[model samples]
Every structure is written in C-alpha cells, then in structure tokens.
Target chain A: DARVTQTPRHKVTEMGQEVTMRCQPILGHNTVFWYRQTMMQGLELLAYFRNRAPLDDSGMPKDRFSAEMPDATLATLKIQPSEPRDSAVYFCASGLVRGTGASSYNSPLHFGNGTRLTVT
Target chain B: DQQVKQNSPSLSVQEGRISILNCDYTNSMFDYFLWYKKYPAEGPTFLISISSIKDKNEDGRFTVFLNKSAKHLSLHIVPSQPGDSAVYFCAAIAYNNNDMRFGAGTRLTVKP
Candidate 1:
C-alpha cells in the first residue's frame, strides 16, 4: 500500500542549531500538510500545500520556522536557530482533495511516522 | 487558540465494552469532521470521517456521530479490544477552507 514517508525518524540538536525534516507524500496526492505534536499543544497545524503551492503557513512561527514543497514528491519543514521550546514530533501528511457542492470536502490525510526532534 | 477541543486527556475502558471519545468545535464554518487513531511512535491514522450533510458515519465497529447545531462530534468503538488502545485525535475542516484543525487528543486504554 502507498504511504507518506518521512526521513530521520529522530534528531537531537543543541539549541541554536538548525533542524530539517523531510517528507515524501503518497503518489498522486496533491495536498501536503505539516503538523507538530507537543505535550502542551498536542497536534498543531504548521502549514499546508496544494498542488505544490503553499496554501497557508500562518500557524508556523514566522521568525524560525519555514515549510516548502520544492517538488510534488518532496516537502520540507525547517527550523533555524532551533530552541528547546521548539522540540516536538513533526508529522507530514498528504491527501487528494476533491468533490463539490454538498459533496465537497478535503480528503482525509495520510500521515507519515513523524520526525522526533529534541533540542537541548 | 484551538478551534477544536478534546477535553478529556485519557480514558480507560474494559475490553468488549463500548468506548466513547468526544470532541467539540467552535467554528460553525466547519462542515467536515474526522477521527484519527495514533499509536506510540507512529503517525495518526485516519480512522473515520463525517461530512456536514450526514449526522453519522460508520465503518465496521467504528462509528462517528456529528451534531451540527451543538458543534459536537464523537467516536464510538463497540466491543473494544486491547489492540484498540491508543491516542485518538479529532480533526475538523471548514466548508470555506481546506485547513484541518486538530484537538489535543484523548488517550484510550482498553484493559483486557
């Protein structure tokens, strides 16, 4: 079965270092999303893309976080000068959104295993 | 501020009993709702979903109930099994937007 794939299952870095997480969405899926799960915040949507175009990144921290879909198959989430507070399990999800009218809806996302980041 | 909320942090249920997990949303614009199940060290898996047009949807032993007027939704698992123990998250998508908002999740422990 097809599935979203994420790399670097775990990462540990010193505060102020850069952390990068990568995801390969399921084939034929046009939408990609990035989420972070923390003990306090739970699951938070950081950004999303549709057709390789960013739909929104308002949920992400403008100063340190950036998300991009460089190509249909590759999506990335990067945090520069990462801080301990930024540590969390980052998840990548993808879906093929379709439908219209009463039937219109975003398809359920297929999530990757996630990247566990630890900043000390 | 979280638009979707799962107030309960954890739940314990005996095996073979019914397990109910609840979620609430504040946005009336939200017309689609979903339930995701996550195991430790794994990604959340799509369990089931319900559209605004329908109040309920079912897949096998899993059932989802949506109350539009009350802005509430719930997932019910009948004959809960030990393998069913996991963290469950509630997600919502607005009719006008494709962004999906998620709740804090409720960890369910099925005692065998």
Candidate 2:
C-alpha cells in the first residue's frame, strides 16, 4: 500500500500569508514533481526534483513560489505572500525515472491525494 | 502555448459501450505520451502510456493509440463502466526531458 503522501489536505489563510505543503514520496522513487490544478489554468507543472536534485522549476513563479526536496522522501512547496490567485489544488507525484538513454526515460508518476489551499 | 490539447471538454457514453477520448499535441519533440484518470477531490492516477516508437499499446480493458504524423493520440475503453467515469488528462514527455506538459483534460461520463 505504498503511495505518495501529502499532508494538510485542506488549508485556508488570509492574503499575504505563507503556505507550505509537504509531500512524502514513495520510498525508493528518485523523482518528485509538483503540480497545480485550477479551473482556469487546468493542470500545470510547478516544479520537480530528481535524485534529490532540482531539475526543471522554470514553470514555477520565482518570486512567490519555491519547491525543495530536503531529503529523498520529503519534498516541499512553499508560497510566500499567498494570494487568492494562487488558490488551487497542489499535487505531489513521485517516480523512478530511468537513466538517460534507457530507451524510456520518463517513468509513470504516482500522485498523492493533493492539498487544497484557499487564500481568502 | 498549449503543447498538449484535449479539444473536447467532456464526453458521454452508455454503459457496455465503447468510449473514446482523443488528445492532440503540437510539440514535435515529444517522445512519450501518457493518460491519467482523476476523480473529484483526488490526484490524477496513471492509466496508460505509449512511446513514440510504437503506434499502439494495450492492457486488459484499456488501449492507447498514437499517430506521430498527426501528433494525435487516443484512449479507448470497451464496455465502459460506471466506475470508469472520471476526468482524463493527456500528458506528453519530451526526449531526455523531465518536465512533462499536460492538457486541460476531458470529463467522461459513463451512464449505467
């Protein structure tokens, strides 16, 4: 029953407040991804970490959003001065990406239940 | 720009019938594609995937078809079940790239 775990399934805070979402990836998986889903934007990649190393985070807002993999199992996304525009369901996913030139480089990601954040 | 696109926002099918969900991508560099299913208040789950080198892939009751020339892909479910009703998302992976782009998604309703 191993799966990606996300905490604080729901959150509500006033504008300008800081919000932190945590994820515990499935053990042994080396890749972690963060995504934001909203009605207007659909689903978008916020960032991802591979081998505990940040890979592509260009999709994330540099000034307001930050994502980090402090350890292999723990990945975190933090939003400072959270705004109503940032309210959305944040998902964390993990997978074992095959090394380069492995025929298949992208491994299917297993996502967690997600954290629903509301900035009122 | 939307690299991946699910043109139809929603689709409906009667139970025990065939269900087809289509997705199109504009990125020629995309080398792999994946389909995911998501229910309300939950994360998207991986359903199936296919590599650019292959035209089709199948498992049990699900099958995926890819058309590289057209940059189109489709998911087919035979004997659609009530439980199969969910939002389906289309995703594409570029070569040697870890950043995956996703389509808006299509909501599928299977009537019993």
Candidate 3:
C-alpha cells in the first residue's frame, strides 16, 4: 500500500539536544506538510513543501526548528537545541495538487503515524 | 488568534442516538472545510469535506452541515456507535491558500 512512512516512532532526549525526524511521503505526492500536536494546541502546522520546495515555514520557530525535503521521498524536520516545550507528536502528511489552481484545496492529505517526541 | 474554533472540548452521547459536533470559523476567506478523526497514537484521518458552495454533504451515516452565513459548520453521526468515539478536528483552507488552519479538536465518547 502507498503510505507515508515516518521513522523513530518515539524519541526521548534531554534539553539542549538536537533531534531529527524523518518522513517518506507516498510516491508521486508533491505536497508534504509537518504538524505538531499537543495537549494545549490540538494541532499546528509547522511547515509545508510543494514540489520539494518549501512553500511556507512561517509557523515554525526560525531559531530552533527547520524543515526540508532532501529529495522527493525524504523530508526531514530538525530541532536544534531542543527544549522541553518542544515535546509533542509530530505528524507528516502528503497530497497531490494539480498546477497552482484552486483544486489544491480539494486534495485530501494522507497522514503517517506520528513521531512522539519527549524533551526533558 | 485561532481562525477555527471548536468551543466544546468534549462530548458524550448514547449509542444509537444522534451526535452533533459544532465548529465555527472567523475567516470569511475560507472556501473549503474538512473534518478529521483521530485516535490515540495515530494521525488524523480525513472524514468528509464540503465546499463553500454546498450546505450539506453526506457519506454513509456521517453528515456535515455548513451554515455559510453564520460561519459555522457541524458534523452529525446518526445511530452513533462506540467505534465512532474519537477526537474530531475541523479544518479550513482559505481562498487560494493551501495552508489549512485547524481548530482544537473535540473528543467524542459514544457510550453503549
């Protein structure tokens, strides 16, 4: 089955550590999105890339969090000097959009099992 | 500020009854809306969606109703089942924007 795959289902690290989460999107899907879920914040968009180029990362903390797609199949989110506040479930989703038209709104995102991050 | 809002944090319903979950949006630019279901440790799954042009969409026992004038929407599950218990999130995409803003999910428990 074509499903988005995420590595390291769970991660535990001390504060000030660098943590990385990886995602392999479904083949042929050009849109990939990263989201953080927490008890306080149900779910917040961290970043998104279209056609392997980042379309927006405005929601991300520029000083600590960074996301990139090294290749079509591999997208990564890294946190440098991870803080305790960064503890949350990180999810990766992918979808296909045709051109720059409004039809992109109709494309439903397919999500992967998330990475549960714990920063102590 | 949160563009989408689910005022109710949790809800409980008896099985075989109707369960209604409400959502409100502040952005008038939103042209598409979607509902997602999530369980512990798993990612959210797309349940149903409606366009700004439509007021209602139904799939199986799940129905979504949109009141564009009120900037509100709702998901109704008839004959609610225990298996339907989960967190439901409301999301919307603005016109010409693919960024989907999500509301704080509402946890629903269907008691048998």
- Please provide, for model 3 over A22-115, each residue's C-alpha lDDT reduced to its tens digit, 9 standing for 90 to 100: 9999999999999998776778998999999999999899999999999999999999999999999999999996544246643688899999
Tens digit of per-residue lDDT, candidate 2, span A17-96: 99999999999998899999977556899898889989889889999999998888799999998999999999999988
Checking candidate 1 for backbone clashes, the offending pairs are none
Q: What TM-score quantifies how close candidate 1 is to the native fold?
A: 0.96
User: Lowest-scoring 10 consecutive residues by lDDT in candidate 3 chain A?
Assistant: A98-107
Per-residue accuracy of model 1 over A27-91 as CA lDDT, tens digit each? 99988999999976789999989899998899999999999889998999999989999989999
Docking class of 3: medium
- Fraction of native contacts in model 1? 0.48
Q: List A-chain TM-scores for all predictions.
A: 0.93, 0.93, 0.94
TM-score of chain B of 2: 0.98
- Fnat values, candidates in order: 0.48, 0.46, 0.49
lDDT of 2: 0.90
